[model samples]
Target chain A: MTAAPTIFLPEVPDGDDVGLAPSISRFELERFICGELPPERRAVIDRALAADPALKALHDDVVAADRAFLIEQPPLPFFQRPAKAPSWWAGLLSHWHAGLGAAAAAAAVVVVVVVATPDESNRTKGGVEGPRVSFFVKEESAARLGHAGEELKAGDQIQLAVKDVDKKALVVVGVDGAGSVTVYASESVQGGLSKGAGSPRVLPASLVLDETTGPERFFVVYGDDVDTLLQAVDSAARHLGDDVKAGRADLARTDQLPLGAAFPQSSVHIVKIR
Target chain B: MSISQMKDQELLTGLYRTHGGRVYARCFYLLRNKEEAQDALHEVFIKVHKNLAGFRNEASPLTWMTRIATNHCLNVLRAKRAPWHEKYKQEVDVGVAASVAGGGGAGFSLLENRELLRLCLAKVATTDGSLAELATYAFVDDMKQADICVLVGMSAPTLRKRLREFITICRAEIEAHVPGVVFAPAPI
Candidate 1:
């Protein structure tokens, strides 16, 4: 009636040629799986995997082992994940890094942490406040001029400029991450994409030009037209149920509204540096 | 999907739909017991939904969740050692032994082979130098490499070296303990 002795052991395989264990890391393996590694490395590994059955078997085991570990592990909490962008991700913005694992996928959630952790002012993701726009013009005083633009009511006349027109420009306005409103514009607006019908089409007015705009020198008309454009922008932008609270719709100004440059007047461009 | 195409709400919905189950399943694997996994999964999802706004293209969501799940399961495991895992281990062994002993009955059919395979695996699992607890956590639960890497911080090279040694230990222990059960020793 003695209690059975505990534990069972298996027979060791007959060969001693298992070789030194692989040196690749779980991260590198992930990069490999993600196709993040260079083509050469992938080619080499693919060849290796195809050539040796044992190696291929080990590779499958390795992948399976990873999968099993993932299955057993709880989905890690994404809320309080890392803040700074991983170097690899920040480096390659074009590539959509996806399905890597809970760790790599968790990158989406950590993004929240990173964005919030900044803005020393502890800005909450509160409801939309009114648009607070700032026009980073080529001049210094113009920077502060935007404060006035926010207070501009309808019928107020102001002059602004026409920035580069891309097929579909990525504009940044009121908000940073959430403010890219691609507006299709008229043919007259430099590189305007879509326009016609004997007259020009109204651009999605609030469009913010990219850095390559070079602070292009031109003028814009602000009055009933500007107000109408702004309203249209606000409406179209929030159409997707965003209720976008524009910070400030900055309209770049140069001088009195243009009264047709060809009116027997001048080609002389003058900034009243008063 | 294009960023412009999916509205925020749609994106949020997609996040839940795609990742919810696997995440929960993983929790179950970590806990190895049912309720604990469920609880952990609930907590993570709630946190994710609440904090979706702050995402700023930082660390990927996968990394984020692994850290959370890793911390959560580890917390649960550390909190109560013998409760969940021990009970599970006992039940599994008993179930296997009974089925094998049962007169080649219904439950003994498919599970029979699976049980044998699992028992063999368990035996193999023991040979690693890891304590029964550490070994319990290192299961192959169908995670991607990144996820597994997060769970086990030690690099692949390190794991390879240690796993071989650990497997050897388990094999020796099994051979010494189980009188005549001849089985192939897993790689050490």
Candidate 2:
């Protein structure tokens, strides 16, 4: 079968008559649906929708499309699927930067990739390890420090800031969730960060969380060489849950991390979801 | 009770209750296949379970999930191109041919019609640079212009201009692919 013909866009003329309905642009309608329009403009579209059944039908169609587009797939048992990031998720983050110029600047930052040893003598009440690496999540606007077990709500813009991180170290970040493990960011995988790049700093971009975002433990693996460190990251990325379930994945374990090994040096930071 | 205090299963149940329908719909439309869509939905819920606690509430949960589902499905499509999409395409083609015949693809469910619609929307990416991303946000994701602006880091005027161009191109493409399908919203 022949491939469908590609649609080529014509050069859009300035003030081109794009055949929109009178007094209502497509932008206005979309914004109206999202409740982003001003009250006066919203009232104008409201009158338009009320006056014209065709316009109302169009409105209904968009809503219907939105609904139709959201067909949920059936659920499966969590253990049925591997606990690794789907192959596509790696490219998923790159999609956000495809046409989004400078939007990366707005993304949440990873201030430090802390790798610490677990000390049973210093274990906390909730099974949290005594934080080997000191990290802070400070609300950008309020400058309020987020404690290790503090609750953060939606709309909270935080910077994951770290102090005294190794300048030559590579940072690997991975999330161990209820069902799957995903490596959302890695300084080594992404590209090695210089000392300045790896310095203690608040993620310049704001952090946003959601309701299904459960308590997460971010594992920050530090290494001297990007490639050498990432070998362990790749191993971790591939076997995030396998080793974790056996408790063998713990970086603090002497077996997991032989002291002075180029790889296996990392810290785990756990954030409580409230 | 605090949301944080809820069990993992309970938290997922609540999220599924609130956004499940939309998340499922978005997955089905993008994947255009029942089984894969179902798989995508489960993956989305898992990600939600992992990420929801840190949700910043800037956008509604529905919006957040829709964004998640969109990217997830796109990834699914991108990974296995040959057999998966080819089979899906043939199915959609048969459905379209049936629709043209007068039954309006009665054999193909209404869900198929919407799936076919998204299939055409996905084609908008093939046209040229930037249009694919723009089309995804505007038509597939139904994002607001203001949010699109922040997302793409384009000025309002640039965003509007490109979107208008996008509308014109997508309408022509969708119409060509699915004759008489009124899936494209009327502009203005």
Candidate 3:
């Protein structure tokens, strides 16, 4: 075999000649800002910033950018996995049900009443004495009942609890800022809603608000036929049309669906701010 | 103390408050798009959160996060499938020509120019992903070889060998793109 072909190679300059760009790295600046750097390193950065107007400007930019981001996108409940109901709450529920006779402790009985007294703070929009729906917001590891027409931002996590309604199926839907109607929580059209009779029981799954800005209206309807209720809600939403979908008109107008007096319905609306 | 002790939400919020700007800036620099940088920032932090336990005191938090962001952005660029050499053909050609005109066969150093460094990274990544990563620390970050060894968890000899392999690939790429252009043997 012929001799191996000679490979040509380029000459690399000496370390001294290699011109590494003279500038403060973003990483260094971040560590300095967060107090992660040693005092000596901080001094180095301080001197550099003082010596270079560009570096000073960059430092200011970094601070302002972080501030704006924090203000605009504060950590919301949806960012973390939905926390389970506290163990104390579960223990209390078990104890209360154990104390009451099995006959008196029907699954349909409102457990929320035993856990916490009902107040205006626990109610959603159009809070009434009889069968109704309420909303709760989880924040800072605590779940608080949401106020009527609460102003929430994108990424906020919310749970809906229904109370005092005896029905085979329950359907919950929301008209979002885009005016599109979505079924928030419900069972299959044929199966109806899950846990229809339990008063003040939270519906399964927490809803993380989407990045749409405007009014979002939610409707809770409970009845025997899930399909009919869905149809009625869909028809009413379509009737509301572009004005409601575009968020130009209020979603409350669809509160009185053609489903008539047969099915009980309640509505709550929230303003989504940027 | 390890970052693992912090709760997920608290850690995430703290990371965002402290280093989000720098990560976003790094992503934007690499990707050259504001929206893609924002998306990359969120993805990088999610990775940071997942790998929080692996964080050591040897590397500063920002240094570790920068490595993740750089790698993530490089992968994004690699996934784009755009021919980086072709994308920066004019700039590379002009740079090579200028370097050659200076005579003495000083050779062209891709490390000096960010665009050229990106082109080399994109080209080298196709053949060897790890080598491309090593090349990034050597060239883009201007990290010392010894520091690179510590950062990449490679011994000095291994780091040198991999870097040589990376430089070889980069040379071939440049030769293929700008025929007859000489390259300075990169200082490892």
Candidate 4:
């Protein structure tokens, strides 16, 4: 009988224990576990969990915790609901404070003009020459938007383009009309846009103004702090009344507020849809 | 006031009607305790009302509300206790070691996969930082291999090798907890 040849395989390398990648943030993990990731991204996590026992186990626990809470809690009562800013009527204060010289600027230029360069102090100490922000409206068959306010009608598609947001800032966006104000985008610049790294930031979804839509005011505030801007909007909305109009001056007015102290270099653009 | 803004309060009321139940459920789930969850319900709804205008409907309203609820609860928990990362990691390490030592083979309900999975990942994170990083990026962050490699600073061959090792460990753990649940051998 021939002796069987013996083959030896070396022990599998356990791999070097370098620290985690900076890009894989704790927030990202929470979002994944909570099912907040889009389908394509979610699949990536699903595959990894499937192949890795430890990750699968961790995912299981997160799922379990979520399930436990869902199972144990009772429905909340209506009266228990917290106070919120009214949605429909454009607050007069918000309309009044919509921009710096908003009323005047809005009256002067019926068309929206995007300011490419922000105030020097507002610019990062040595940041890349800021991102160019433009508004586009889908009119007729083509998406035509030369400036901020260029005649928008019912069912018109509204989109915003932010160029060169090299990942240093955040973008907060909202639409305030006589009826209601809607925040379209607010988050880190990376999340607000749909393009790849180094691409111009564009709103992920195209907003279509419905039939009831009237003189909708769009404001794009570019800076570092989203929460602060949100608070400012809240404060402005609270004191506002129904008569406040959407003017370019209201948009410019934001740059002069104490809130602008934190976002000195921030660009606030307002567009009115009629 | 414009028509839409006029309906803002009504819109919020409508939102409560549609999503209040699920929001409370999510708050309780993360908070674990009832009282904390209840407080979170009010805080979360207020946040919802303020941000309601910004919601672009890119995601379902329920999903948005759930996120808000979860964030509120997480913040509350963070404020009340020690850092979750350190606490969870320390506890997870000990549990993972015990499980791997051939002692955790008792019958666990297949339905308890979520709890088991959480326990197992904590252990994995402690034992192998590289593996843990890979698992987090791949499973938690859901980054593609190319992106992960760039982020982790690993070559394709090295990443592939590390991934294989991670899978083997994970599979073993699964088999230990629930026999035949993963990678069952084919019949002869």
Error of 2 at B85 (Å): 3.8
Tell me each candidate's i-RMS in Å: 12.7, 14.4, 15.3, 16.8
Q: Each model's TM-score?
A: 0.33, 0.38, 0.48, 0.31
Candidate with top TM-score is 3
What does candidate 1's lDDT look like per residue over A19-105, in tens digits?
212434333334355344678877866775676676567566655655654443313212210123121112111111121232222
Error of 3 at B170 (Å): 3.0
Ranking by DockQ: 3, 1, 2, 4
* Chain B TM-score, structure 4: 0.47
Residues B55-124, candidate 3: write the lDDT tens digits.
6343578778878988898788777655654665666556555555554144434655555566677777
Model 3, docking class: incorrect
Residue A237 error, candidate 3, Å = 33
In the order shown, the chain A TM-scores of the predictions are: 0.21, 0.40, 0.50, 0.41
Worst 10 residues of 4 chain B by lDDT: B106-115
- Superposition TM-score, candidate 4 onto the true structure: 0.31
Report the lDDT of model 2 for residue B69: 80
Per-residue CA lDDT of candidate 4, range B1-188, in tens? Answer: 22244245445544654555556655654444555666677677668767877864635565466556655655555454445545654554454444434333332221123334443344465466557556544443344466457656888678767766765665565445433442422121
